[model samples]
Target chain A: MEFYQRDRTLQPAGYTPIYKTSVARSPRQAMLSLQGSLSETTGPVFGQNELGPLDNDLIRNYAKDGDPIGERIIVHGRVLDENNRPVPHTLVEFWQANAGGRYRHKKDTYLAPIDPNFGGCGRALTDENGYYFFRTIKPGPYPWRNYVNSWRPAHIHFSVFGSGFAQRLITQMYFEGDPLIKECPIVHVIPDEDAINRLIAPIDLNGSIPLDTIAYKFDIVLRGRRSTLFENRLEGN
Target chain B: MVQSLDYLKETASQTAGPYVHIGLIPKQAGFDIFENNFTNIMADENTRGERIIIEGRVIDGTGTPLRDALLEIWQANSDGRYNHELDRQKQGQIDERFRGWGRAGTDFDTAVYRFETIKPGVVSGRNGLDMAPHINFWIVARGINIGLNTRMYFADEQEANATDPVLNLIEQTERRKTLIANRDDSGPVPVYRFDIVLQGENETVFFDV
Candidate 1:
């Protein structure tokens, strides 16, 4: 896999122009939402929260508190570089549909009515070492326009926070072979060769374990050299 | 330089800061534009995701990621729709790409992060008008928590930005700083890299909250 090293000198085509504009309050307000103790060294802070609204689908199944299904994935891992160095105290969050493709939020309407047995969202906070995770269900692929023919693969959404306001990233993760990969407009936006091998969930069909207890592990590596970059497993064509 | 650094440090404690002056951001690169890259908030994944390679380093005023510093970005989906339950359209159809929201944290040396997402679509402005494509960004650094309600537009989007109501609101001089549409129709993925600095050189940016 070849990597496109950015030539800082080389410019992007028709990039958006910047115009001077006045804003409401000062930028100081930006950091207000965070909980930082000035008395403390400005190190990373990790946040924890209970599982969000269990969607109708997740509800159908009996939810036991300590069950592995309910047992927190404890998504604890460090965001490392190609060299495996830790990126300090960054902010992280994730959201996905219930196991059945429905969201706990009021936005979605694609899947069949409701399974009444799923949880749609979870959030994680990284400790001083830049790591965070959310216990969440596998998001399902749904249909939309912009692309003449296609639906996105079931996947999770991740947002990484950093340095300046523009230092942010929002992207999706797909299950290996979700069938919706081929024509996704976002996937279409990239040349097939340049697109990284996508990450996907392996099926636990044989079920060496009980039906209710199942797990899949996926690792995420951010923008880097393609050789070291994880391949994007295309799905849902 | 060392003496001045110390002096400025003392001053920052008493001063109003660049955000109050409103004059400092213009001198720096990666300034703010009301329309484009980081602006719209999405309700869900499909219509509001921001998929792009965000590469840069953490540095003190000299240039760096503040390696230990953290960054957060939130925006609307490709269809210019957010995943918020309240943002439902008149048709009762939840906005596509409104994958509502998402977040990622930085690693020890990992200053850069990227996402695979479709480009966002045009959106309705606060004034009930049009806006160019953009993503919203929230950056957290040392004592600097800059909220930039900015946007990143494509270079070839001249025709689009021209009619964009938000872009039209600004005066021409400031407009160039806000809009980042450089004419690079030939590059790969039509890259739009916007790096931010917390203080000094190119200071971190701020928008009207």
Candidate 2:
């Protein structure tokens, strides 16, 4: 059991026709890579009796009477694995667009304004060393049609998993100094500027909470597993 | 295992956009904030074998049908094992009433995506070879900037999809009929179908796992 493959040059470039819906959604053939079997070294565990102590609290999980108007933050990090190890218990999930970029979704017609005490989304899990956090509110900058003024930057959409199913990922975090993450055409279909600076995130005033919330961090790596035998137990799960 | 010149480099993938169902199915975008939601029913009437259903449609490249995708699947349980703890620590069997993982979504007006699960058996692969029953999908949507992986096999297994070492690693035997899936026993159970295209002409073969 030694799987570890994904690094398609740190991905993103499957027909980046300036990200206009990636021009008919990429894939003009030639993908088939294979090798990691047992369905890519197995995945799907998420226990903690299937979450919900407000599942990582997206600012009170879906508050209605008071708390969800803007700038609260948190985010946090860890889930590592390109050999920096620590992938422990993994599943992260997240979602955004409130403080005013709007998106309570019914196809977000934009024009920002839906905060009836926001309900954006959340979920966490990591632990046993691979940390995880959540909290939320900061989400704004949105406007997309991919280019007649395409704006999207205050990101946050995670969705990790990562303890193999080929360490699934689904990214988007960006927020450090967002110059719209350098004019994102979907973050310029990553031709890697250090993999788009590891999807941004920064601002961690020592995991903030000074006068209530404001942190950021955002680490995540996922896709690396080795085994050979540490008393083998079925590829050392 | 030496790698790590300060490891970390993986992140970059952006575009589960058009509000990915307000974050992966927030009660299918109307947000009831998940109190146990993710469904497509991964087996239940006391879980055990044959059942089936699967159905599909992720289509795209002008053929339309993507009602914002979002799939997820993983299989095994109907005896080829895997409810995973490395196959329950090497097959000490498990079907603790099966929930072999599912999560479906597409149908915000029929971009169709069904699951209902069961039919999984034959597993083993790589060196031990077997692997025919298949299943494992993963998809993701809104202009999908990443997350695609595939595999669904089984058109009545046709002699185990012809010695399926991941369909003999496709080297184009008519593009391995884009990972089979046909079946259709007309109703009550066995459906299969499996569409997933994502780009020009017969696409669906995606896997880089």
Candidate 3:
């Protein structure tokens, strides 16, 4: 198999100019000279066969006898590489807050009541076509201490694993029309508004199970690029 | 100079956030979804090589521990052969029981993550040179946007560490210490402490890949 060539342009600059604090910690010197070596090639290899058909639903676990209390929703999408090829058998893991804007985590001291049924965690492997589907409740916005009273937009955390460790991605997917998105510090960290917009999932009524759940469609384009003209090449000149 | 027609761009990255453990380790988050969690023991008693424990903390720029950090490690087996198909086919036989991988999340209270596994053997690098015995670490926490990649080399193996191709590439000689784990022989099982600093003076040398 050929080595996966990554396009550097589409990737977020380690020290985002807008998010100035990132400069302090993000590697400046190493990023310039380092390239993926043999170590990168020698990473984890997971097979779909090793995984079993078990719990893939985020709304409810087996111990919880009933459905999770929340606004029932379905999140479906495809995982593709930069060249628009389907990345098959890759693990897609997701976690989110319950519909009441509360997580089932210990450190989350938020006052929101924890839904007895909702665990807000799910895992699914992308099929041969790179498609992954999950049944999860629509997460609610929650307050954080980013400022005095900052509320994070309703979002689901996503972790995707490619063939090698270098291709692994950890990101968040937000709702399409969440008003709180603009106010969120985490979302604002990305300098590119267009790139931030890519994180939001659009409503897909067709994908929703009628009378049971609404649906949101989000497609992850991992390590891909768009065409940009160089400054040296001016068409007018 | 000529201009290239198409240049592919990489996708942007985001922080794994506070709730990463909830998804990756559901059982740890009070859910019994999986029979075994993602960060369970890497090798069993039958596995070959000297058993060792790796304990460390993921600290931020201010030296505060990141309680939410989740770490994953991948390494070659005792015989320097990976559990992967290519390596197994090339190297002839690999220890069937050895998984060559482990994962761990920092304890919410203590903010320390630990893994128990055998010392990895020297593996052949891309150029066929003997690469140092090191474990690849992938880390994600609340503040980290993209997961940071680093390697933990054995501090005792000075000779091997000296010749490591990756370690030699570190231009700043001082920063290399951040990658080496100090051996603690006091414990019943040999323990190696490899604290990874995300920022400030002793930040671990993270790879671009």
Candidate 4:
């Protein structure tokens, strides 16, 4: 199947002058010019047989015990290709902070208390319909050292693996109507307002289980560079 | 408000952060969710070709080793064929035991990553030219917004490396050496040392794909 071609403009320019560290090692003109010639090599060959059923649950680490200490929520969505086709059996991994805004990581110096019940990580493979669902808690906003008094908006990190090596994407999904989104340097790096809006997942009441859990829908669209329209089109013929 | 009236733009990229290791490889991160690493080995004892070791450290621009970097490698089997359905159609038989994909996180203390696999054979490149035996590498770390894509070629395969379509495409001859892993046969097993420098004068060539 023909996948979406790589779109240079839609991707963040490596040496974005705004992001400070980007200046240090970001590719210069020479390296940027060479990237166009690099072709897709071997893609991954993963299948349902290679996966386990328990891989999908974020709360599975505490399965033998009680629930994790947080607001229970279900995050569900489909993994679509650039052509709008469902990508089945692809791996979708997630990592995020606990409801208290603290991570289970060692380097995370956030002062919030760590919830022993929450492991804060999970993985799920898309089904035949390119659909995946995660039983996770609502992670809280956390502070970072990016700048003085800079607190990252409540967000979950997502890593999606498509059919080929070129299709791999790592992005963060923010909650809808988060006030912190406007101040986020990472989110603003995209340069396109519409694309930034796409990263926010709307609250899906329909997917919620009434009293037990709330649900958020986040559909990921993999890169497909088939559509390329030039600027300044002639007046409608 | 000027609207482009075109396709949807691709999503923005972000760093893998310090939590990537905890999520992906819980065992390595001390969580111990799984018994073994997600991708500890690419090939088994029954796999074909000469067994080799690829070891290297990921260094940042400041010359400090990136301890948080997570790396994943995909390559062809000893027969120059991948275990995927597409390659299997072309090469017929594939080693059942060879997964042809492995993942390793940089050691917390040493900041070095290692992978053990057999030597990959030449594969057909773009326009039917013979490509060099190379292992594809994907690297992600704290400061890296997107995963860096690169390839590791063999230094001993000078004949094959000379005609490699991808290597030749590199206009600068000196920059091409960054992709070739120098072979050290002095060890018990053949070792190929390929250090990846994220930035600086000897920054490894990272592909945009």
Candidate 5:
């Protein structure tokens, strides 16, 4: 996996304090795509499955262009406490999709494209209520050597929260029956089909909202009595 | 529309009497770490056994649904005092009268991560200024990390607002919208709705600090 960083000497100084968003003195804008009517608000929309993580340290970024595997699809979701309450100001982080349908963040790499527009990774902080969301396109499947002439299903890799090294999860969201599932080597790793269903998000087509502007809602729970079978199989990092 | 708050009148609108205590309860990390960090956290000495709730939702740019994020809040008491080491050191040097500083931790899994603490106090300003009474928020969701350094100004405080040093630092265009606190629609948690709009078209106010 290839990791890249940005330059700071090039940062122009002025009203934008340049350190923290709160202290930005000039040209302060909301980081999301806010589109809506009078009372309601609709936030940001990045490029096709294209957006980088919204870290407070926007000054720095990790590039994925030089990596061997490529589909840089940025996958995102939310995390809530058990009580069905919004914890409001929480942090969410995930890095997947390289462009050629591969991951550049290490751990998982199936060889995909390295999209320039799609940073292949993105990040967003949840609002007041524990509602965390992201703007990225669903990732496509890549062909692997699970079996001769076999390809993986269309899926987006995911991880939850920023407990640093102590907390990091690796799972993939597969679209409904994609035929390739029959032979994908990775999918075969999980012997049980019922278990895979848990991670597979039900298809909720964004018809009225087009793929370019589709909305997928996926929530994650860190630790609680209601544990998913997936966690039972693997431990998050 | 250049309007100021009605201070005394705004204070009149608030439910007066006993001010409450709040605490910070965060989930620890590591295996077997699943043990509730709250049990011992809520019982900490600083919190004084007072239960205060902070609640709100997490949403996206398109007004769509989002879930599974962690949030943290740290601020001063209703009297505008903090329990931090720095605040303690500056006590007499800064503003001997205001204690303004403390931190609380909580998570919102079902669409909202709320905190419970008595509303903070608007600390008297140093070098001739007034500090806004608001809590600082921090969030971490599936692979995202964000921070918002803002204060929840009471909707009613017209006078104190006008002279607020920090609030004044914000541009006139973003000031009004940012300096607001909404009432909680749910149960009587003394809710004040404060939403943070990330970068994009129309965004909420962001600080320069």
Candidate 6:
């Protein structure tokens, strides 16, 4: 029942004022660290039965007349622990703007027209090998109100649930060659270049469909469980 | 296990953004796509315990409620047992009907999130001491770069709350009140109001676990 401690240095600070929202939302007091209790060690599980047959296929899940207009691509990756162990059967959810850089959301006032055929959302479950793949259109970079000329890089939002509640993570995946990744204030939150590099998905020609779609590989790593032996459970395993 | 490579570093996080609803809860964003959608209802008629409703708003420094905020809660059953695999093996039995987890997005007009659940019993701490009844909460929203974690303790449980190991960890005794949820028994079902302040004089105590 032992779990590895989270590395605080790897995580972004709460008060990155350049992000604008941090000015009003960042806490003034320092956070308190605690050992993982039962609440933190356990999380809700989503089974295969809970998902639909087309849940992992964004290309056709919500398509009406024709496939969404854009560069068809496959986003494939593995869910692993910090210890490099495969985290199987975890739920991974994704959402993004269309290739035109316009979200279906009503609040998005971006001038880019919304693709009527694109829903821009999908879900997938990792296999025993912790592998998952989804078909989607390449999202377009878009503008935001962070600053006068603040524009987000082409990215996809991902929500992942590991075995433990403490392992729950929500992040954005950027393209490897996207230059905007270096300029976005949000991406600059992490001080380490290596940490930021892990978020970028590299092109995987080996995984690409010959005539149909290109493929990008983005593997996510969650907090790991330590190999410590618990005195009370030594006989159990 | 054959060790081939070093453990990979955990990936950096980004904001959920203004359009988080499109993926996390697509049904609320005008698309009824998910077959099994999660709601604030974690308990049913057969679930044993005192039924209660937890309601609150996430207020910012300017005293404005965040309309885009989303919250998820996880707690033990009324019997003080979690539905998790480890807890199930240790506790032996739990109310299977009690899902013990719920997700709720703030209302567009009201900016309040509510959860219908049964009051949880005392759970054991790491040292095997009795911990006060509380619910673990995880929050994220448009402006939040990383999800925040906090807990809600019942105000009525004074005796147990006084000795709570977790609550006592807060050096500032006055700031501990931020974690307490006030109870209103005037209604049919007891309602506990716990407003989480992200930044202000009454900012809630967030945890780094």
Per-residue alpha-carbon lDDT of model 2 for A32-98, expressed as tens digits?
Answer: 8887767788877778777888878888877889998889988898988877878877888888889
Candidate 4 residue spans exceeding 4 A from truth: A1-3, A17-25, A29-41, A225-237, B1-9, B88-92
Residues B1-209, model 6: lDDT tens digits: 88677877887777888888888877667677667777898888899899999999999889899888889998988878887776743543588888698988888789999999999988877767677999999998876878899999999999999999899999999989999999999999999999999997899999987
**lDDT per model vs. reference:** 0.37, 0.80, 0.76, 0.76, 0.38, 0.87
What is the C-alpha lDDT profile of model 3 across B1-209, one tens digit per residue? 78874522345678887778888886566656665456747888899889999999988767778777899888888777777554632443578888777778988899999999999888766444567899988898776767788889999999998998788889889988989999999979999999988777787888766
Which candidate number has the best TM-score?
6
Which digits, one per residue and each the tens of the lDDT, describe model 6 over residues A1-237?
Answer: 645777768877778888998677777788889887777888887789878898888888888899999999999999999888999999999999999998887667899998988989999999999999999999999998889999899999999989888888899999989989999999988778888888999999999999999999999999998755556633121
For each candidate, the DockQ is 0.02, 0.24, 0.29, 0.33, 0.02, 0.56
lDDT of 5 by residue, B1-209 (tens): 87953211000000000000010121211011112222212112354322345555544445432344344444555555453322332222322222222223223235554555656655545343445665555443332212333345665566777776656656555645654766654675456766554433444564422
Interface RMSD of each: 22.7, 15.4, 8.2, 7.3, 23.8, 2.7
Clash numbers, per candidate: 132, 0, 4, 1, 135, 0
Docking class of 6: medium
Tens digit of lDDT per residue, candidate 2, span B29-122? 7768878766888777888888888888888788888887888888877677787666533543778788588887888897898888888887
Q: Could you give me the TM-score of model 3 versus the true structure? A: 0.88
| Tens-place lDDT digits, model 1, residues A1-237 | 221232212111111111001111123223212111110111122223322222112222224352212322222344433223344555554445545554443334565453343433334435556554444445556664433445656666544433222223344455666677664544333222223243344543443235443444434433222242464631101
**TM-score of each model, in listed order:** 0.38, 0.34, 0.88, 0.90, 0.38, 0.95
Model 6: runs farther than 4 Å from truth? A230-237, B1-5, B88-92
4 versus 5: better lDDT goes to = 4
Question: In model 4 chain A, which range of ten residues has the least summed lDDT?
Answer: A32-41
Docking class of 3: acceptable
| Candidate 5 colliding pairs, count | 135
Q: Write model 5 residue lDDT over A103-186, tens digit each, in one string.
A: 433224444444444444434556655565554545566654423565657655443332211112234456555676565544
